[model samples]
Target: MTSAVLHSLGAARPYAGSRPLVLERIPVPAPRAGELLVKIERASLCHSDLSVVDGSRVRPLPMALGHEASGTVAAVGPGVPDVKDGDRVVMVFVPGCGDCRACDAGRPALCHRGAAANGSGDLLHGEAVLRTVDGERINHHLGVSAFSDYAVVARESAVVVDNDVPFDIAAMFGCAALTGIGAVLNSAKVSGGESVIVFGLGAVGLMAVMGAAQVAGTTVIAIDPLPEKQALAARCGARAAGAPADAEALVAEHAGDGVDVAIEAVGSARVMESCLGLLTRGGALVSVGLPHPDQVLSVQALQFAGMGKRLLGSYMGDANPARDIPAYLQMWRDGRLPVELLHTDTRPLAEINEGLDALADGRVVRRLFTLAP
Candidate 1:
């Protein structure tokens, strides 16, 4: 038996939006049917987690808040045959039933069953395995709360991988790398020699740059407020634009009309609108960031219609995790995706609050929370 101390969201609203998560020794329950008990190796702090902590995105109280991670299967539940104890895996936030309308159409990323489960903060089976020592139920976040020493996740929610793949890289692939790169290749279907621009140089934004590198002859332009991030984006195969004004200038300089594809990784309505403006006539704008629930975005209706432009929303980069996870890992192995460039720091799970603080200030590209045996 392993001792598991799970971090639970304790406050309805964090005191002044700081120190929101409370750590406790929650019961590490065994996986139920069609589930797996994973000993989390590393959990990457996500922007969505930040939103939840800051009270911007509200979920059930006392939920164990983490979704993106890499882990080793400690146990497998009945009916799960493909994986067993000691298997390494990277988790996926959404799980498809394989029978949903979206899944039937080969778009498992937007499966209604998974979306409904995430919305209600429940497992696909409508039960949470985690519990407090006092027998209180602890809500699981997106079916995989990796902030704990262990998490019980549906068998379909994670992909087993070779042990040689670094755990940190696998942890980020679950979210940042997958979503960012997926936006370019999967959502936008950016082709060879296409011009692309990404707004915001966060981890996901940088991943878009890395993803664009895969398409031969693709040109990547990056826009961000932070000079350091712009510099980083340049290193990741993008032409740096220090601000939106500079981005427009770069767009004209690189692509005579405008970029063939523009991506908005910044979760602001203003940024989304600006991305639409960055696209050339008949070009596509892919919005990957999760904006505020109440935020309403608008574009030039007549202009967009006349230009034959498309505004697309990419959830999880329109990724089919079962197919894309292996493809991304193989791409990394083949030396095409330079995901390691975004890695900044790794701290113990105890330092998650500090990690979130850095994320809040935009100080770190990506931080992985390591779990000790």
Candidate 2:
């Protein structure tokens, strides 16, 4: 199996020149207990993956990079009772053990064991299934590591999906669609007739726009510095889309007293503060983007009480893969959620470095890598 492995971090821009990610043919291990061996069909580049490449999110060296993906179950290990061979599955980055406090409370994103494994670049069971020709270990990225042709993932990380779903569309369900839509429907619970302002118009942010648009009478406002992305957001159901400088004017024109829900997907404390300012009294601000470790948000202490405002941190959109992925796919099938629009194009796995360059340059929304056999 050939996998995209990140050997070093903080590589110079134009990743094509730096060549931070290397393609290596490695051995695929058999799935162990509570694990499944997946034949990856499609994998997509995400800002999170770029973060690791650019040294923003540090991880162990020689790590296989990929999370958002869809694959077919080639084989299942012992204790994996539900999933079977030939089943199509969407890979979830956070693999909930189903026994943790957070999982018991229906919050898989907050699973302590999953977080620890991700931080350590191991799978849910604290194991790395990848190895080089010389036998050096390669860390798994968020338990999935779907950048390769095949991957061994914890059973908790694979959610069975209908086989008919296109692998490309199903791949997005693993991350962007799940997080973005979940933010609107589950985290913020934006209802009909409400107004929503989304900061940043990446795949996740744009999906937020799409989700908000699905509700009756909801007004969606999308903000992005890139004109192309803003245009894409408009097409994704944002009633109005523009640059950050024009956000206030758009809000004033479309939403009289600010929006009911303000979603921050830019991962910037500055942008999060701005989101808070765009919310109506008693409105909620959902922070879906992950900020840097040192970044801190400053706000007036009295606003929560005086204006009845609420600030929330949403990880993976508070999604439960077993429940939400199928529902999102169904919405896609019904034409209510046009997730296909999020795809910019597709490329081969060998061109991953070039793809990262496009992603870093904001040239595309979501570029997928076809890995099917």
Candidate 3:
């Protein structure tokens, strides 16, 4: 398999910085029990991947860096049922261990021991599947590591999709699309006629716009610093798009009171605070952005008490990939959700860094890398 591996860590920077993403050839990974070997066709570049590449998040070095992707099943491990070779699939970032406590409670996103399972860089019993030319160990990020031309992911992580859905669109669903749309529908549960304000008009934010728009009579307000992003936000069904300087005014204008739901998709402390302030009484604030470890979100107790505002953190859009991925694809098919607009560009795996750079510079909304022709 050919993969872009991060071999070292340097200053924490965005993709536009000088850190190089190395492309190398290695042996294709084989599936273990309860795993699936997938031949990746399209892998989407996500802001999270950019964070990992920039060293904002702590990931093992010499790691294959990607989590959003769609591919075809090349092989299936023992005990995996129904799915077979040549089946179209999208990879899930969170591969829940079915018997874990969180899974039993129907919250696999918070599964105990699951993080250890995915983050340990080894399979079930401390076995590494990917190695470098010098026989050095290569860690797997998230569970999928779909940045490679091929990947071995747990069967639980591979969501089978309809044949009609294009691979590029399917790949975006693995992360950005799912995270944004799911955050609105699953996490915040924005209802019909509710007013929603989504901060940061990236792929995730745009998906949130589409999700809110799907709700009958819902008013969508999009906030972004860039005019291009604001324009794209309007196209994604936002009732109005405005700068951060105009967020409060925009919310008041649309909602008449304040927004019923405020979603913060950018990983900035200031934006989070702004989202919180934009919410009406008893409104919910859902945060989808993963801020740096050292950064803290400061909220005043008195303000929350007076405003009756609730703040919640969402991961992977509070998504249950097994259920949500298929539903989202169906919504896309029905034209209720516009998945095509979320994708801005596609490149080869060798240009992964450049893709990330485009994302960092806001040159692209959602960029996917075609791992194979």
- In terms of lDDT, the best-performing candidate is 2
State the lDDT of candidate 1 residue by residue for 25-100, as single tens digits.
Answer: 7667988898999999989888988877766677776678889999999999999989989999999998887899
Which residue pairs in candidate 2 have backbone atoms (N, alpha carbon, C) closer than 3 angstroms, thus clashing? none
What C-alpha lDDT, on a 0 to 100 scale, does residue 114 get in candidate 1?
86
Ranking by lDDT: 2, 1, 3
Please, what are the lDDT tens digits per residue for candidate 3 over residues 125-192?
23567888778789887887888888888777789998888998898888887789988998899899
Off-target runs (Cα >4 Å) in candidate 3 are: 11-19, 123-127
Q: What do the candidate models score in CA lDDT, each in turn?
A: 0.84, 0.91, 0.83
Higher-lDDT candidate of 1 and 3: 1
Candidate 2 residue lDDT tens string, 1-373: 8999999999998899999999889998889988999999999999999999888798888899999999999999998789989999999999998899999999998898999898887888657878898888999999988899999999999899888898989999999988999999999998989999999888999999999999999999999999999988888898999999999999999999788999999989999888888888999999998787789989887779999999988899999988998888888999999888898898889899999999888898899998643
Report model 3's TM-score to 2 decimal places. Answer: 0.95
Number of backbone collisions per candidate: 0, 0, 0
Clashing pairs in 3: none
